[model samples]
Target: MEITDRTFPAALVALSGIEFPWDYNEKTEEPAPSNIDYEPYDEFDSAEETTDWIRSWTGNKELDGDAFRMFGQDGTGGIATLWLVRPGQPLVEQPVAFFGSEGEIGIVARSLGEFLWLLAGGVGPQEAVEFGSDSGVPHDELLAVARKYSGIEPRTPAEVLAAAREEFPSFNRTVESWCR
Candidate 1:
């Protein structure tokens, strides 16, 4: 489905257009530390693309990617998506999650509200793999973006990530279990 205003939150739709900063080695053209490690897509990935990706990643053709609304990716092609687990709720209510190209699975934030703060704190969904080990730097633009859209009060990246992990402790295990 298209990410129209009716289908996606205003904040998220706006966020899709942001071009995150990246630092790369000149010689190798590879990612370096202190980079945001995220790139927001201009729009959500097509359903066919999502399906093909999931099938390739899981090695299970039966598993569809319908539950995922992919909007961004990392330098290594790790996906950032809204996991539509809450059946009746809107996209903003769903969890923001990461599926790494290296098989890393993590829940970045419980909702879009927290996700904005997470981005403001400079922790992209892909960077979420490090969890408590990394201290996220603040991004001024993202902070403004978060403040513009999120009515919820601000919280540290640690707080948001911890809450998401606590709420879905079995997430990693569940996703890993699906691997063939």
Candidate 2:
């Protein structure tokens, strides 16, 4: 299935059952801090908006935003995006990566399918790099969803990161080149 297909959204909804430091919204601006819990937005950013953000992030006006489709953000406002490196391939086959608010970047999963397992294993993009796979409590609901959708065996967060980086060794350099 395509990344923009209904299945992708459904998977996100299913994974939403787990408590995170954020809420999913269709649209949001940079959030302000409050005494209450910090709630970040996990909703998918529109393609045009994502493109604009990418261009701004890299300070490169000539770059096309088609290479990325940002889907979520952590409480600290780090972005989670699907990287479309495999030209001519479906979005589902693309890799999922994170660009943190503080210049942290890493490929979190080799594909959308692997990403489901990552969620099931209780690791987000930031957590996977910052805290590793053992940080969060695993969720059964996410596990079931991962099994149902991906049919791949569960893996540790470290394994996921390694696999993605191996498959796309040039990802970091590519992003670096886009930087001003």
Candidate 3:
């Protein structure tokens, strides 16, 4: 997560272009229905809540200045740039990767389990709080989870994992093994 100033803008621009319809459910290895949606998010609350949840998970990092910087193609478009700054260090624009095609810049999920819960239909802040109780979010960490990624639009499992890998490369094999 070491982002150079030169790469920051490029990362933001690339993130804003993230689209979907990832060949996840539809196994092109086999033949299946086109079950993925690669469209811009239409739900504002869901998107915002999700963003809040991610921010909280990051120990309440600021998005505009000291921590992360968000840029969108337009005021109403999806995200473009998400700059994460380490204390006393240069900013790192996280890998906001995608599945199939790129759509727009999007927020990252706090954890794998949280992403799974969200995929399972946890949409609102209160619902996320309840889901946290049942989904191993831990009582102490509940507030953090609720605060981050709660209303922001979620990336797909594949996308989330990809970004997580970029952020925590060593955890990939462990996380995969655990998921299986």
RMSD values for the candidates in order, in angstroms, are: 3.4, 6.9, 16.2
Candidate 2 at residue 114, lDDT? 90
Q: Residues 1-180, candidate 1, lDDT per residue (tens digit)?
A: 433223556887778777788886799664444567888876678778988888888888887778888878898899988887887777888899899988888999999899899888877887777544164678888899899887789988888998999998998887777677
lDDT of 3 by residue, 18-84 (tens): 3422232244442112221223232212335535633543334342122233332222223322334
Q: In order, what lDDT does every prediction score? A: 0.81, 0.68, 0.31
Off by over 4 Å in 1: 1-6, 24-34, 131-133
TM-score of each: 0.87, 0.77, 0.24
Q: Where does the lowest 10-residue lDDT sum fall in candidate 3?
A: 96-105
Per-residue lDDT value at 20 in model 3 = 28
- Consecutive 10-residue window with the lowest summed lDDT within model 2: 30-39
Best-matching candidate per TM-score: 1
Q: Which residue segments of model 2 deviate by more than 4 Å?
A: 1-9, 16-18, 21-43
